[model samples]
Target: MTQQPEKEAIITVENLEYAYCDFKAVDGIGLTVKKGEVFSFLGPNGAGKSTVINALITLLSLQKGKATVAGYDVSRDPQKVRESIGIVFQEITLDRDMTVWEILEFHGKLYSMPRNERRIRIEELLDLVQLRNKRDIRTKYLSGGMKRRLEIARGLMTRLKVLFLDEPTIGLDPQTRMRMWDYIRKVNKEGTTIFLTTHYMDEADMLSDQISIIDNGRIIITGTNWQLKNTLGQDIIYLETSDNIAAIQLLRTLPSVKDATKKFRGILVSVHKDGTKVLPKIIERLRENGISIDTVNLKKPSMDDVFVYYTGKEIRDDPPGKNGTLTHRPGGS
Candidate 1:
C-alpha cells in the first residue's frame, strides 16, 4: 500500500500579534491553514478575527511575529500576498450604480487583467454565481442575498489560491444564509482554499473543515467540529427536576458524570460514559432522593456546547449595526 502525501500549508502564522495603540487586538497567536481546506476563525464580535485577516490580506501592517500567505511573507511581500488572495468583506461593498457584470469587470480591470481575459472571466463568474440574468441590473436593485453572491463573484475574478470571507452571510435571512453556504461549499469543491471569520455558530459548524475559536484576542481552541465537541464528554444530558439545586448537587457525585452546570430550569450534565447507562443511574438516584425529573434530553455535544464549555459564556450574535465596524470595503479601504 502507498502512503498518501501530506497536505501543504497555504497559510502559516507564528506568535502573531497586532495592537491598536494600548489595546492588543490579536495576542501572541499561531495558526495554519492547509491547501484546499475551508479554515474558519470562529469568535464573537471584537475577538480580533478581522484584525488577523486584515494583516494577512496586507490591509494592516504586521507589528510582531511572522506570517506567510500563498508562499509569500506578508510583511516582505504584501502585494504578492494580496494578489494571491481574494476578499469578501463582512458588509456589502457593491457600488449601487454598477451592474453585476460591471462589478466583476471592474475588479478584473483594477488588477490589470487583460481585456479579453476579463470579459471571459466575468461571464464565467456570472454563471458560477448564477447571476447571468441579473448581469446587467444595477447592484442597488439586487436583494441582500444577490448582492452577497455578486461580492463573491468579484472576489473570484482573479485566479487566486485563497479567498478571505469575513462574515460572508452576516445579515441574510435563514434561507438565504443556507443558500449562501451552498455557494461557499461549491467554491471549496472547485479547489479554492477558503479562510473565513464568522460569529455565527451554525455557520462555523457547517462550513469549516477546521475551526479556531478565538476570544479576547486569543485562540482558545482549534480542531475539527467533532474533535472539539468530543472534548466536553461522551454525551450531554439536560435534566429539569422538581428540586434543581438538590439534583445538580447529587449529579456531581456520580462517577460517570464528568461535570454538571446549573441551568435556568434544570442542570446540564456532561458524562464520560454512555448516556444510556449513565442516564438510568441518574433517574434512579434522583428518585431515591425524592427529586422528580420534569424533563430529560440526551444528545451528543454540539458546537454551542463546546464553545460554552471553553469560554465560560454563551456566544451571542451581535446585531449588524451595533458593532460600529460592521461596514467594510474590500482591500481594507
Candidate 2:
C-alpha cells in the first residue's frame, strides 16, 4: 500500500516575540497556516495583528523566534519569502496619477515579467477583480471600493502562494465589502492562501477557514468559527419582559435552561438545547409565570459573542493611543 504524503504548512511561526522599546507588542505567538486556507488573525487596532503579519512577511525582523513563509525562513531569506507572498496594506498605496492599467503594468515590470505574459496576466487579473471596465481610468477617480479591488489585483501579479491582507475591507460600505469578499473568495478558489487581520467579527466568521483571536498581544483562542462558537456550550435567548427579574428566576428552573441572567434591558437565558426550539417553550413558561414579554430574540453564538466571552470586552472598545494614532512597533524592529 502507498502511503499518503503529509501536507506541509505554507506559513509557520514558533514562539515569536516582538517589542517596541519596553512595551512588548507580540508575546510568544505561534501558529501555522496550511496551504490554500483562509487563516484570519482576528483582533482590534493595537492587538499586534499587524506586527505578527509584518514579521511573517519580512517587513519586521524576528526578535526572539522562528518563522517561515513558503518554505523560506523569514529572517534568513527575506527576499525569497517576499517573492512568495503578496501584501495589501491597511492604508492605500496607489499613485493617484497612475491609471489602474499603469499601476498593474508597473508592478509586473518590477517583478521582471515578460511583456506578453504580463499583458495577459494583467487582463486576467483586471477581469478577476471586475475592474476591466475601469482599467484605463486614473486610480484617484475610482471609488474607495474600486481602489481596493485594484490593490488586490496588483497583489496577485507575482503569482504569490500566500496573500496578506490587512483589513482589506475596513472602510468600504457594507455592500461594497460584500462584493470585495466575493472577489477574495474567487482568488482563494484559485489556490492562493489568504492571511488577513481584521476586527470585524462578521467578516472573520464569513471568510476564515480557521481563526485566531488575539488580545493584548497574545492569542486568546484559535479554532474554526463553529468550533469556537461550540465552546460557549449553550444557545442564547434574549427577551425583554414586563418583569425581567421574575423572568430570570423562572427561566433558571426550566430543564432546558442552563442559566439565566439580566443583561442590558432584557433577560438572557442560556439553554442547553437549540435556542430556536426552546424559545416557544420559554415564552410559554414566562406567560405561565405571569411575566409579559415585550420583545424576544434568539441568537446562535456568533464570533462577536465568542470574542467577548474570551477577551471580556468587545473588539471596538480597543482604543487607539492618546493622540488617536495606533501604537505599533516599528516595522524594521
For every model in order, what is the number of clashing pairs?
A: 0, 0
Indicate which candidate wins on lDDT: 1
TM-score list, all predictions: 0.87, 0.80
The residue pairs in collision within model 1 are none
> Model 1: per-residue lDDT, tens digit, 292-321?
998999999998777766655565655542
Model 1 ranges off by over 4 Å: 127-130, 173-179, 315-333
> Which digits, one per residue and each the tens of the lDDT, describe model 2 over residues 109-149?
88788999999999988987788999999998998767877
User: For every candidate structure, what is the RMSD over all alpha carbons to the true structure, in angstroms?
Assistant: 5.6, 6.1
- Which window of ten consecutive residues has the lowest lDDT sum in model 2? 324-333
Predict model 2's lDDT versus the native: 0.82
Candidate 2's error at 179, in angstroms?
A: 4.2
Error of 1 at 126 (Å): 3.3
